[model samples]
Target: MILKPVPISAEQFTPFGDLIETGSDPIAINYGYTERHHDLASLDLLEQEGRPIVSIFRSTPLPQPVTLNVMERHPLSSQAFIPMGNQPYLVAVAPAGEFDASKIRLFIVKPGQGVNYHRGTWHHFCLALNAVSDFLVIDRSGKGDNCDEVTLVEPITVDLSDCEESTAR
Candidate 1:
């Protein structure tokens, strides 16, 4: 039960891949007043390894777009995303140790950035608009199924919520 929340930046994402691009687009405010453009980019990371092991891919992502209901938790794994095309939307779930209304955050994987999830870390699925979101994922892979879901007692609004309490940490 630990709530150590930190940003998965270039230094942290390096072990997973290389940062070579950055791009962005604008996201409008609700009142139809203020508008802000976001940056996105493409990135490449070479993860060297021994003999034949995990499969290498151009952009293999989760088949199903995780339609998150509020936020959820995974008791046994951490998930990571590396934005390859457009900017990525990062929502997340958390263990009680890391759960705090003032702490949970979202990360924008601007085109050139990517990430590697530590084991048993709670997270949200990928969020991207316009073009396809791509990434090189590194995680435990096996024939056996590996997924567990836990609904939160209270749901959190992803698109519409208080500005301060929600965002990538």
Candidate 2:
């Protein structure tokens, strides 16, 4: 099956998770030097001795016509990925619960946007586009195996033909 990605938005992505982006009504803080987009995502940790851990994931661009054969989920806590640079990326996800390949959805995340997958939401890893990128990853760190992976019976091909030519490569 071929999957096409659409632009990421809070409304459309709410079922799977939160869309981390700066809203128009940001609060001015630090003597007006900083604008805080407060409470963008709800971190669902603290289950089964689960604690939040922050890390940086450096990712390289995927090969053209990206194909995904596996999906993973964090059953114990939510996972958030914030890009450290002004580059676009792709997000592939499915709703929490039974692993249904047909329920998968793709999104094109532009610069200045990030994503927070709700606990147990099935998703693919960071998909950097154009060049190497770094993402600030926030997720759970504790016992009882938070991650679960499932290999797809049929690989899904992500079609980038509709995306901007520059980033599609």
Candidate 3:
């Protein structure tokens, strides 16, 4: 299976989850001192939830045309990834329920865009395209089995050739 990533847009990504785009207009508050893009995503967490965990994930860049063998999902909580730098990255996802190889959708996110995967949304791990990138991740921290994984019977080749290429550092 070969997968080519598409540029991310809020509407196209709506089915899987929210695209917390920082590039959009913000709500000015506190006497115009603050710009807030409020309530962008619904953090649907498990009833027995632990405090949300905030951490930095620094992912090394991957070369273009990489092979993807696995996908995973967190059943207990939604996950958000906010890029700390203005570098493009890849996001691959599939809808919940029995995995369908044909249903997989790949997104190429530019800088200033963040993503929130609804609980149980099947997705690939972060695929940084440029220099080592850091992401601000917010999600459930404690208790219960939160993850499920599936190794593809046939690995998918992720090709970023059509998009603007980046030098990996």
Candidate 4:
């Protein structure tokens, strides 16, 4: 089944997990006096060609930029900043449906918070909204395709109704 992208805010995104907002660690916001605009397309790939029995779709989502203010870092993850790109990208997510509150938690990454994917942990694709996000990924990169997935029991509908309303304000 195809899953539409949903926007998870830090406030709401955390319950599903922990708020990895680092602010006290030096690697976080301690980078020496820095001044420069950086552009990055993390997973933005291009679809090559289609074969008789196969099709291709490159990373079409254009990379969006935002300032990532940091304070600390996750020592476990090797990846630095995993781009969530402009349009919210759908990675692997819990199947859409009711789940055990004990096993699954709902959390949102606020506009300023970006999460770095550990080498192989399961997660939803990047959800870039308006600004640059500093993410501290965690996992084992030694393994190829370090990505696995868990379809939620049902499906989730991202309610952009509020964002739509706020946009008009």
lDDT of each residue in 32-133, candidate 2, tens digit only: 999999999999988999888999999988787789889999999999999999889999999999999999999999888999999999999889988899
Question: Top TM-score: which candidate number?
Answer: 2
TM-score order of candidates, best first?
Answer: 2, 3, 1, 4
**What is the C-alpha local distance difference test score of candidate 3?**
0.85
Off by over 4 Å in 1: 1-67, 70-79, 93-103, 143-145, 159-169
lDDT values, one for every candidate: 0.41, 0.92, 0.85, 0.32
Q: Which runs of model 4 end up more than 4 angstroms from their true locations?
A: 1-103, 116-122, 129-140, 164-169
Model 2 misses residue 98 by how many Å? Answer: 0.4
Q: Whose lDDT is greatest here?
A: 2
Residues 23-108, model 1: lDDT tens digits: 34557777879665444322212223211123333432323333344443333333445554554444343433454444445444
**Tens digits of per-residue lDDT for model 3, 16-70:** 8999876467889899998998888887765465668888999986665678888
Report lDDT (Cα) of residue 54, candidate 1: 34
List TM-score per model, in order. Answer: 0.45, 0.96, 0.91, 0.36
Candidate 1 all-Cα RMSD: 12.4
* Model 4 Cα shift for residue 20 (angstroms): 5.3
Worst 10 residues of 4 by lDDT: 66-75
